[model samples]
Target: MIKVVSKIMINSSAKQVWNVISEIQRDPYFWKGMSRVRTTSKNGNALTRQVTLANSEKCLQKVILFPIEGIHIRWTRGMITGTKDIMITQIGTQTLLEVEMNYELHGIAQVRSRSISEELRDEAELAVHLVKEEIEKTQAFPTESRKQWADMIHE
Candidate 1:
């Protein structure tokens, strides 16, 4: 399996970062090359979405969210079969966001594994950067977001 990791430090609380990342619906905005995300199903904390890549290829992804800690999105179909994890770490008032994507290429993609791996790395970096920008741009911590995390933590 090829692993691509990206990390970033944002000037915000982990809860603030968690709110933006855990929304799931806003994924395409942060995940570069991803054209769209359509929720297909939801069961408990796990959500299944149809993801459309920039190349117009479609894939199914199962997203499992873990409160303020992390989110695990596993590509269940198409040319990718792997998991992408988004982890949040709290450091004082700053939040450290890290994303790791582990996947094995299939068919023709396996032949171009090196290039695809490089693209994944770049995508991961951009994902975190966009997330950082979104949270920092708003600055204000939405009470609904805070309460949402609070409710999940208590559950």
Candidate 2:
């Protein structure tokens, strides 16, 4: 098992951040590597979505959303099983977001390969960092996004 954790401070309210994070399928602009995310089911806090990556790879991700707390998502690709957790907390005028991912490499080849865990951890960390940067760009520019996020939370 490989673990990677990343945290970022966003100049936004926790409610605003939570709203954006909860609605995983609606905003492709905030996610850098995802080309598209379409919801297949919406059963309360649990949602199943088909996500297409930048490399045109498509996968199904099972996401469990927690309003104002965090989201947990898991998916399997080939021999790699990935689990990602994203959390947001209010800190006065800003929001603190943390993303953690755990990956497990299966199969005999992975067991024989050295540094597989490190490689996976590095990839997960980089992915979370890129997402944090993408999300912060919205805060920096406040455009229509701030209002949209605020509306979602209040409603």
lDDT of each: 0.90, 0.71
Worst lDDT run of 10 residues, candidate 2, spans 138-147
lDDT of 2 by residue, 1-155 (tens): 67777777877788877766766765456555567988888898897888886657676788898888988988755354688888888899988888787867566536744575565455555655555565667665535624677688988
lDDT of 2 at 7: 78
> What are the per-residue Cα lDDT tens digits for candidate 1 across 7-110?
99999999999999988887888887789999999999998999998878898999999999999989999888899999999999898999988998787789
Candidate 2 runs further than 4 Å off: 26-28, 76-79, 105-155
- Highest TM-score among the candidates is held by which one? 1
